[model samples]
Target: MDRRTACLHQANAFREKALADPEHHDQWIDEAIKWLERAMEASCRAVITMEGDDGSDAPAPAFETMAPHRRVIVRQ
Candidate 1:
C-alpha cells in the first residue's frame, strides 16, 4: 500500500485500540490523530509531486525579485 493508505490504516488501528482499552482511550486517540496527520502529509506530498518535476534547483518567482516595498500582483 502507498504511504497515505498505510497511515490511514494505522489511524484506524489506533481508533480500534482506543475502543478496546477504555482506560488509555485518550492515548490511543492521540496516536490515531498522529497517524491521521501523517496521512494528510502523505496526501499533500502526492498532490505536490507534479509531472516533470525532477527536484531541480528552480528559479524564484518574479515577485521575490521586486522590492519589498512594492505590492505584488498574483495571478491565479
Candidate 2:
C-alpha cells in the first residue's frame, strides 16, 4: 500500500484502540496524528518532486503521476 493508505490504516487502528481504552486515548491520538503528519509530508514531497521542483541534480521525470489522496498535502 501507498504511504497515505498505510497512514490511514495506522490511524484507524489507533482510533479503534482509543475508543476501547479512554485512559490511553491520548497516546493513541498522538500516534495517529504523527502518522497523518508523515503521510502529508510524504505527499508534499512527492508533489514537489513530481512537478520538477525537487532541487536534485538528477533529471526530472518525463511524466508524473500522483497517488490517491494526494490532496491531503494541500488541505494541510
Candidate number with greatest TM-score: 1
Model 2 ranges off by over 4 Å: 47-76
In order of appearance, the predictions have TM-scores of: 0.61, 0.57
Candidate 1 per-residue lDDT over residues 28-71, each given as its tens digit: 99999999988877665412222335666775333223223334
lDDT of 2 by residue, 7-28 (tens): 8788888888888899999998
Q: Looking at candidate 2, what is the lDDT of residue 30? A: 89
Q: How far is candidate 1 from the true structure (C-alpha RMSD, Å)?
A: 9.8
Q: What is the C-alpha RMSD of each candidate to the true structure, in Å?
A: 9.8, 8.2
